[model samples]
Target: METVDEVDAPQVRQCPECGATVSVHARFVSWCAACDWNVDPGAPDPDRGRLAAYRKRLARRYGQQLAEEIERSGQEARRVGPDGSTVLAFGVSLLVHSVSGGLLLAAGLLIIGGWHTRILPVFGIVLLIAVATLLPRPGRLPKGAPVLYRADAPRLFELIDEVGAAVGTTGVHAVALDTAHNAWVSTYGIRNRRVMCLGAGLWEVLSPQERVALLGHELGHFANGDVRSSFVMHGALRTLARWYYFLVPHPLDSLLDLCVNTLVFLPRWAVYGLIVLLDGLTLRASQRAEYLADAGAARAGSTVAAVTLMDRLLIGDAVEAHLRRASMTAPEASGGSRGREAREAAERELWERLAARIGSVPESEYERLRRVSARRGHSVDDTHPPTHLRRRCLASAGPHPARVVCDASRTRSIAAELAPARARLARTVIRYNAD
Candidate 1:
């Protein structure tokens, strides 16, 4: 179909279906009302098959490139940093802390020794103040305190272990299930043990094959050593940030804070600037790590299944948002067994509604979403590359083919085991908001 150059003529467009000059909306021109022709000739909407094939190719290429980059990073760390980049970062941090601490100690000792006679009381008070201000406060722990639940699902654990083995990583040591529509593999404890967190909502939407793909992707992070490297960088950066924030005095909350803030501001700012510089330097590598993980997922399952899992996530997120908005308008929960049952029923209804919404989305709509997500690209704050990019990377996944970890019946059984917790969590949301 022919299209219109409405960017230059926003107010009017000649419809392709009918030769009528239809009035345009002046925004993202949806369609001509006169003949219902699509007026906004945006991106080139390629045919579905070609687009899918292109995506697969991109995924494969990205995955290969990522593997190479990760290998190089490991080699580079060994060559340049000796003990590794993370260790070097920590060593530098320790040196900085020690120097600052020593200086503070020296200052206190000199003040007390010099003012031992007449000005001792006043000097002691002054010294105490100096010590308090100069001392670096403990760094704040990472926020977004994850709601961790026991990953007591035996079948789920076995699946994770199998995926980990396939991906060539020391398998996940701990598992947590949370409410969000996401999944990740991370480290915890002094030993830096691996923990995999699965979003219960995400699990509900994924098929058995999709679940394997998802697990593979998470486990892949460990295989690529993304978690371990990031940990060191984060620790160093957090230490600097903590010192910066802590230096700003609190009692007055304004004027005193401002004065202290000024005194420590320049050094703190330098540290922050350094963190930003480091992030900028490492951003591309981090993104590559994500692509490699997706490749790993494609290996565990089929490329199509991996991509489908990502596609469903876009719709699943929308579903969650819709359910939340609906819950806000729900009637207040009465404190009784009957009311509790009613609220629980409403929660269940919302979940069904969510699943239905996801199922109802057209293939064309999904394609459109892929286009938009790809176009948006990755932001500075984003650790993973954009979904479209990841999809493209997986397209080239030839080495990793589909491997079934669980049958349909086993998946259903696993779902049943976790169903009670998810249900309770859903009902809790409804009840909590009712008040």
Candidate 2:
């Protein structure tokens, strides 16, 4: 038996049954030249078949489990684990539950009272600030920036247009390959309403079928309001943080700071315990939201493709996460960073030399910079969680909540259903604020 990655050419050996030359590479077993003895190739074929079946069975089971976990959590804001234990994120912040009407009323009264008393202009200024906060945040992409949907190849502009149409949400304004192995849409432009291809690395590794699932996953975000909810949360966070900062006056800032430092700098064990409690609770709802997004993808495209993409995303995510974690310890990635550029250059050279040795990369004088990229990314404290953690959110998933009977017509049907909603929302949002 030979591996696809390792084997070079057909192996020739004397037949065990007779002193005759026999050639074997894949499952095929040719007739021995001397003895003319033919062997059944079905043996290897069945074993391969069995292995394929087993892999598929396991993949589906894992997918189902992960899906179940997500659906359970998404609907209830609880992390329902294998043992049936339910944990939660820190108690829902007042932001999640605050009634807009109440907040507006309070804001209105504050403004009027300030004017009535002829007080400082702070209250009216605050109300105006609050209104501004309500606007949706957009992703960060310039207009029609070229996106390398995948390394070595770019998804056509028309395909992106088609996908945006299917989602019936904001169309992709710019495509950028994310450094991570997974794919996502980042809000770009004004208030982050524009979508950016957040998965350049992912597109690099995934097959076309798997990429469709990845696309569908983004579509899930569109369908499930994940994007909208994220912006809403951002506004809420901004609003609360503003209030907290506002309340901490110059006089009290010192005392408040002291208390925060003391609590945070407590015994290592104590701090860790507190963080775990908060994190565990927060993960519950966050995990659940992930499932709804998964379900959204399944409903949007072929389920089989979705599953396939997830599997690739899982395995590849491991490598990406390793690089990401390493980045945390890695020196800062800048021209000033010591040896960072040199180290990356060295790695790139090694891979390129190997690729050239294997004919994987084209030959050119400038081929050295051909597809130049650092496998390691900067560890910026961004909204996205760690790569491995994000991967588990999908890789360890269970069955899709709704089974998709994928067919030629399925794409059109899904697109049609989403188009009207996307158009209406686009128009309304264009008129209204993004958030």
Candidate 3:
């Protein structure tokens, strides 16, 4: 007796463009094996705004350039130092910081001399308020996200520490769990303590090894000396953005207001120009850092695991679509109920449904996504290299054995430790979707 799988198996067909054999799956995209015809049927349109379009072009250009350089020079592309562009980025950053400092100094001088001239104090106070508003502060974890310390998640921390050691960085000081479909490492507090934010959506879908690869990639940012992530450079960029926000013209109500806006126009635009220049200068280096981090992912998890991780990232849109669909249908599914009971039911089913959705994705779909990525020059964002380029770089670097393994025992233990955070994130996701 033929089972459903055998009866519904994919049929092989000849490609119209290249006369190559292709498998036509019932529920997945089919493209030419040789010519990539129909690989990206819905080709991405140009980004909406001129600046956004420019950024996309710049990312694609630099991504390809870095890939070519890596191919030509092999290991030389991984070396980190203050290259001319980096030096200039830092110089521009320092100039912005100096302007902030000069304003602070002027405010201090005016306040100190206020006893001799009363009006000086009011102006000093105003300048102080401006400085306060513009001062750059370290990022904070999301207010309602589940924050975990070492005591709370010992096993999870152990896994992260192992990955971090493999990547040659001090491990994260804390972990925060959220409902996002992304994960990132960020610094918080005056001491610059590292915090790794694990998105439950992404975390729940990944295998144990892929989780390690994710950690390796993020920790690699710290190990690889990415200048853009550093305190001084990041703070300077933030300060400049703040300055531009305040200096930019507003709606004019009177002749005096128009005059003031006109007076500040040059300085406002100048600040904007500096922000663009600094961003452009450091962007290439940041993209290089991302490739290096992908290497770190391969090192910590085996090359196969790292490659699969990238494939998983390619399916993020699919995952998001699934989530959206699930969220939208939750009300309909729950006997048309609303509020706490319905949300609780959705929360209970969210992770399981996501896992099933991701697992059900056919092999052909992954292949189609890979081809589409190559055709579209797909990227995570402007800051990172294209996904296809990163995957290719990992493949070219040869197979790497896992330096930090996440065996069944450790995996189970880590899951046990993360149970609370998982539940918290699930509730958050359900509530957010309901709203």
Candidate 4:
């Protein structure tokens, strides 16, 4: 099946060997995941036009107004929490904590029984309160808030099958691509189907190969089930984790947590402090995921192509500048200008880091290309890592790519490519966390 990964290949909907949903992800793809019948994109829906095809690759479903609506709707959706998943989780966390607390309470009683050893009572009481306070509670995302998805581009649907087959994956449920040159896969709707977002910004900037590389990385997310798993994980944890990202990253986040819990009178701006913490974590994850996705991208599009895409992302600071402008354009009247400003600043910051990590192209070549993408109107942010670190991982990566081509999803496939390497990578990640 031709998948979302192979952009250069022709889009066909019919199978020559059998009449099935022509697998678009791979050539000679014969089966359809949705309906067992084979279908092909090449067979061409008589209604689709060459012009529509071209524009579809570049335009959005609705203008900015529609996007804002979708953004609005999505926020409400994230908060639904599915019949008290949050409440259930909070209950579970409480139960877990209560049991431990009960044990401590008993210890405290025992200590008090032997008041001669006052140290045990003091320690038990203190630990008991601490665990009880840390217990999870039902958290809410304001009564009404929306989580936004990437722009839905018109042409992104073209890559769905191509990307799927290239990675041996299947099914992109929702079509979304914007007029901008960026393309990404997101999920929305209760159905939990794939929502593809393509920006004119992305189409204008990335080379076809680079686009294919990204598609493969996204499909890796999908075919690998990273997308849905992320959704579920986030859904379950959102309430419990309201204060989590704040506790984790950086030495100071823990301090921030102490102030919030102990003082009991946290200033609103403590949110700003958490933002600072999350900013750092996001930057780190972006850099890390870049290497992983790049590894997958390489398998999707030769190693050389993957490296080149990193170079392209780095050289393309104009993208950052554009996103900065777009963000700035959001009505200042919106509830949170400072938050917007922070996000814009963060994007620029990430784009800059991307340059430092992915360094190999001559400065002169890099500058020239960055300028060119700037001219075309594709905007990128600093979220990507430096190319050098990424390239190094790939260069030193196992000679044989993982058999499953970076499968993070639950697909039955050949033995995972480079099991030892995968295990090492997982351990490396764990140790990094241990730090």
User: Where does candidate 1 clash, by residue pair?
Assistant: 56-395, 58-392, 58-393, 59-392, 59-393, 59-394, 59-395, 60-393, 60-396, 299-400
Candidate 1 lDDT over 293-404, as tens digits, reads: 7767877766778888878665554657765765675556666887677776777675556555455554545664565555444211235555665565455434446764
Q: Against the true structure, what is each candidate's TM-score?
A: 0.67, 0.40, 0.87, 0.37
Pick the TM-score winner.
Answer: 3
Please identify which of the two predictions, 2 or 4, would achieve the higher lDDT against the true structure: 4
| Runs with alpha carbons beyond 4 Å of true place in candidate 3 | 1-30, 43-52, 74-77, 112-120, 248-261, 331-345, 432-435
- Count of residue pairs whose backbone atoms collide, per candidate: 10, 28, 0, 82
Task: Arrange candidates by lDDT, descending.
Answer: 3, 1, 4, 2
* Whole-model lDDT values for every prediction: 0.59, 0.42, 0.82, 0.42
> Across residues 233-271, which tens digit of lDDT does each residue of candidate 2 receive?
444444444443343323336877776555545443343
RMSD (Cα, Å) for all candidates, in order, is 10.3, 16.9, 3.6, 24.0
Displacement of the residue 100 alpha carbon in candidate 4, Å: 19
- The 10-residue segment of model 2 with minimum total lDDT is 370-379
Q: Tens digit of lDDT per residue, candidate 4, span 276-367?
A: 33333233323333344555566666665565665565434445454444444433333367755654444334323323333323343453
- The TM-score of predicted model 4 comes to 0.37
Best candidate, lDDT:
3
lDDT for 281 (candidate 1): 43
Q: How close is candidate 2 to the true structure, as a TM-score?
A: 0.40
Weakest 10 consecutive residues, lDDT, candidate 3? Answer: 331-340
